[model samples]
Target: MKILIGNRNYSSWSLRPWLVLRHFEIPFEDEVLMLSGSGWREALQRRSPTGKVPVLIDGELAVAETIAIIEYLAEKFPDRAIWPRDQGDRALARSAAAEMHAGFSTLRSRAPMNLRASHPGKVDLDAVAGDLHRVETLWGSLLEKSGGPYLFGAFSAADAMFAPVATRLRTYELPVSDRVAGYVEAIYALPAFQDWLAKALQEPWVVDDDEIDVIQGRVAPGTLA
Candidate 1:
């Protein structure tokens, strides 16, 4: 199997399937197409019909979209246990993942995922506060219901689905409750997350336009990326 991903620093969508594969210890060849330059368009077109990153190519199947790729992986490798075995938990997990896939447009648009950002950048209050509230509510409600650690008590697809948003909230310094903050920290501390961070820190290409806005001017205080 081979997976094509965008630059590690700014591609939250790309990170989703990569992290899921990493966390599950699924062996796959990785082709990281460094972005922030003009060459990515041609490369992305060849790998992904939609000209997007994070395309998964297996022996005879090609999958795009993080959620779709993950679902395909789960079905193909049932032993990986990507989702819960229990029917109820699995159903809830799917629900959460679907919500993540479709909602949170506000936060995504205002606070683009830049793991290398200096500080918790300023929140676009008008554009993002509502989504922030909804996300916080989602985390709080899930944690309160599940009672600890991850949203579903174990590392499931739901966690994988929300991992990028956790990074986004950390980057933008969105207001979140203590429980949600801890949840975000947990996702950040995962070994897969650490691996991605380490790789991102080493990347040299930076999109000048997006790289221009540095609210705190020093890259997230003590952040790894």
Candidate 2:
């Protein structure tokens, strides 16, 4: 198996399936293409037919989109337990993952992932308040229901799907309930995520366009941890 991904620092979509493969200790080769300069588009085309990063190439199967890649993994490796075992739990998990994939555009656009940078203050929440509230409610309910250190009692696709949101929370210092904040912290503590963060910190490349979200226009406050 092989996955094509973008730079670790700014590509939230790339992080999703990459984290899953790492978390599960799945044997896969990964290639990282920097999402900078004028050649990125041509580079992506050469990697995946969809012309996107995070495309999993397994034998003849090529999966695009984070959710699709994960689902493909689930079917191919049924014993790995990629989704919850219980029917009801599995359905709920899928719903949450789908919501994360299709919605949350406001938060996504306003706060791009910058793993090497930290912003400790809120710029403002009004712009993203509705999405923020829904996330809090969804996370709070899931945590309470599953007694979670993860969203569905164990680390599954749902957690992977929302992993980027945790990064967004830290990047923007966006307000969230203590429970949700703890969820973010828990995801951060995962060995897979930590490994990704270490590499991101070491990366010399940077995309100037991605840093525009830093409201104060200040330097990196500290390591994203």
Candidate 3:
């Protein structure tokens, strides 16, 4: 199987399913498509049915969307424990993942995921306070219940979904409680995540749209060095 992804530094959506495959020891290859520059959009449109990155191509089947790709993987590999094994735990995991998929717009918009950049204080706390609270509440509750270094206790798909959020919290130096901070560290310590981070730091392409400095007007567009 092959997964088409965007630049490692800026493509949080792409990172989700990719992490699942890697963490579970699934065999797959990945291709990186530039997220910006001339013809990039057309390139994505040609490669992905949804005209987006992180499309999984397995033979004739192409899966668009992160959650869909993850579900497909779980279905294909039932022995892998892609989600929590218990029925109740599985439901909770899916619930949390779906929430992450649809919610957190305020935090997401204000602090776009950029693994290669660290801009503490760039985000306005007032703008994303509610979203941050929700994140802490959700993650804290899960961690407390699971007694985990991960949300579901063993690095499941739910953790994959929130991996980028952990990055965002750390990158922005957002205020988080001790428990939430520990959870973030656990995410960073994942070997799969570490591998992704190494590649992200080496990425050359920069998507201006996700650059906080540019968005905040502290750095002029196209002036990044």
Q: How close is every model to the real structure, measured as TM-score? A: 0.89, 0.92, 0.99
Against the true structure, candidate 2 reaches a TM-score of: 0.92
Question: What is the number of backbone collisions in each predicted candidate, taken in the order shown?
Answer: 2, 0, 0
What clash pairs does model 3 have? none
Question: Can you write out model 3's per-residue Cα lDDT over 25-50, one digit (the tens) per residue?
Answer: 99999999888999999988999998
- How does candidate 3 score on lDDT? 0.95
lDDT of 2 at 92: 96
Error of 2 at 145 (Å): 0.5
Candidate 2 residues 1-225, lDDT tens each? 999898999889999888889998899998898787679888878878888888999989888989889998988888888899999999999999999999999888777788888866544578889899999999999999999999988898899889999998988788888999999999999999999899988988777657744334554623222
Clashing pairs in 2: none
- Report the number of the highest-TM-score candidate: 3
Ranking by TM-score: 3, 2, 1
What are the lDDT scores of the predictions, listed in order?
Answer: 0.81, 0.86, 0.95
Candidate 3 lDDT for residue 209: 91
* Clash-forming residue pairs, model 1: 118-219, 118-220
Quote model 3's TM-score: 0.99
